[model samples]
Target: MPTPKAPVRGRFAPTPSGRLHLGNASTALLAWLQIRSAGGTMLLRMEDLDRARCKPAYSASLIEDMHWLGLDWDEGPDVGGEYGPYVQSERGAFYREAILRLQRDGWLYSCYCSRAELLLMANAPHGLEQEGNPRRCGCLYLSPEEQETRAEEKTPSLHFAMPDREIFFADGVAGARSFPSAGDFAVQRADGIIGYQLAVVVDDIAMGVTDVFRGWDLLDSTPRQLALFDALGAEPPRYAHGPLWLGEDGKRLSKRHGSVALSELREQGVASERIVGLIAWATGLIPEPEPCKPQDLIGQWTPGRIAQEAIVLPGNWMDRLR
Candidate 1:
């Protein structure tokens, strides 16, 4: 019998709070390019764990938008994989186990500070942002008695205790990066919610992810993740920070600036091919050519060709999509 091949895995995870936007579509395309170029398998996961905001319509639209764009996932919520239950919301027990493991290892503690209290402390005149051991909040200093008393009064949040050293890591796309990541960061909220830092760390480790391609906006969050990986004795995955697309004002593209969702763009008569072409142009996968379909562009797409600098979208590009 032939030996089983080790699957090369890449994933696209979108929250179901809204339809996918241009920026998000671009990201999905880039990730697809990377996975395709590697001849690897790609997966999709709905980051719809936030029950208060998640909408079924939005989730359906996300899948529909990806289908319109011709992006396919080899494994996901729709199709079962060895890693079933791809949605974070469905993996509650996994997170619970991770939290328990961290707690037993003395890597995490329970915090009981309210949001207002934390804000007041953070905004104090003498507030400090320490490097490796950045003073996040003084809540870490609370004695066991105080913690128990607070626990009896209400619920306590969980925090990951960071070490005192500069965290540095090599980026696959952006190159060597280092940052000061001090401060006791929250792992679980007082409302029994797991923070991104904690959730992503546990998920990546569990999924055996080898690479991570995300926007430059999340570059700052890398150090904290690195710290978590170190604390858990897990190897960090290869990292890449793709260039972010901005508006003419040079700010990040957001809904406030008329940055509609990807599905909305489709509804407004924007062709999926043009949207892919725009991303290719902006990311330097292919320079601005006259016009082309998404399939034609993907055939020549290369993830390594993405530029490091953020590209601002042109107004006429939207018109071209029409």
Candidate 2:
């Protein structure tokens, strides 16, 4: 008998910093369709690591919005799973442990440069070099004594020592992608909070997520995450970066783009089906806008059907909905 294939597992992780905008909702809808279509398990993880901005109320509202759109998760903060702590803030110890392992394996170094100094260095003539070029930073060569001395003046952030080589991966939607191995990035901030790159990799690995579907904006960060996966001896998940929803100004959708938030639309009495239908139409999964539920789109959902270019919303897009 043939060996049984493992079930696919996917996740929809969002930061609870603000209300869910059209961009966020569309991503969530696609992610839900992908997992549900494959008979895979879906998980919801709240990226509430940034205590300063992430509000509990925002997370609660996000859960409500997901439900209103008929998107359901097999596991999430609201519904506990084997990965008990789905929230990033509650999983700090895991990140701390990963950082310690990286340090022991000689894959990490202490960065003592203050924000002002780093910004100044970046703006210097030498900093104009291409991103793939090796970044010149004296902090990487600091002696133990010098590091100790700098530690007294300012808390040192942890930086991953990036390998100088090219990293490549085949994205489900965007096709093959390549990134130069250059900049040594931080895994921990000066404030001691764990960084997004490190935290996301650690959580995904622990949660056994086999696939990640997110916005195209994060496509550049894939190589960095892949490098971390290698250092941690974990297989990276397959990624699908869907095109972003842009406003009339040709910029990524944001609050500045007008009342695009789902909450605001809900308050305006816009039906949830209309929101789901708009997303389906915008993503090229459907030809025209018509009221539909999340489940109604599953049969037609395919990664290739998604547009490679960002969808530009019309200046009067809101008027059509109204």
Candidate 3:
């Protein structure tokens, strides 16, 4: 007899660097739909590790925006669950444990590369697995004494020595994908902040997340996280890279684009249902942009319906949503 599949456990981890925006809401709705359609548990995780920008006020507003949009989670920083501490900033012990294990197993090396050195290298490798942050480091070969000397000058960061093998995976939206060995990438910064690659993987493994449904912009991050999962001896989650939302300026949405900010929209008197409908229409889930609740989209959610290209919001998109 064949074994039964485990229930789907999906998650949406939002950073609190800024107010929630339309693009953020659309992604959250899609993630919620994926879990709800499959009778799975949805979880909310606060990616608030960056102390310089992420603020409690932003997180609170994000929670309020989610509530206004009719989205809820079984576990989150607000609603306690088995996963107790849902904020990444409070989960340092888990990341430190993984880093120590990686060090003991000799899978990690200390990097002392400087940004100025990176700027001088015209041939830095193309991919850093992070959008807008292309980087490559080669200090993995430094001798112990050389590293010791460098450590005396500057506190070094830990970089995972990528295993010399290709990674292959099937994405639900982007189709089959492969990546060659990327050079050493950081797992911890010199200032003791855990890197995104390490923290996200550790969180998913600990939370028992079965499916990672998020924007396609993060497609490149999978191989790096998969490698981390391999080193940590934990099973990685199934991934689906959905279409990324872009602004009228042909750039990915961010906090700077205030027109689509959810809080601004609320203050301007835009109904939550209009936002949901516009999201549904933009995602190709509905032929007409009609006002409805988040639950209305759950029953109709299908991976095939999402556009393969990035969805662009027009400069006057508010008029349509209005």
Each candidate: RMSD to true structure? 3.3, 3.2, 4.4
Residues 1-322, candidate 1, lDDT per residue (tens digit)?
1211446667787888877877788778887777776778777877776788998788888899899888998888888677757788888887888888889998887777787877776565543543334455655678988877888977888888887677888886788888764567788888887787877877777776666778778888898898888887887777878888887778877776574577668777877777777778777877674355555665676556778888787656576565
lDDT of 2 by residue, 251-290 (tens): 9888889989999999999999999999898898998988
How many pairs in model 3 have backbone atoms within 3 A of each other, for residues 3 or more apart or on separate chains, i.e. clashes? 0
Computed on alpha carbons, the lDDT of every model, listed in order, comes to 0.76, 0.89, 0.85
Indicate the residue-level lDDT of 105 in model 1: 91
Best of the two (2, 3) by lDDT: 2
TM-score of each: 0.89, 0.93, 0.92
Question: What does the lDDT read for residue 117 in candidate 1?
Answer: 75
Model 1's alpha-carbon lDDT is 0.76
Summing lDDT over every window of 10 consecutive residues in candidate 2, give the lowest-scoring window. Answer: 127-136
- In model 2, the runs with Cα more than 4 Å from the true position are 1-6, 120-133
Residue 204, model 1: Cα distance from true site in angstroms:
1.6
Query: What does the lDDT read for residue 217 in candidate 1?
Result: 81
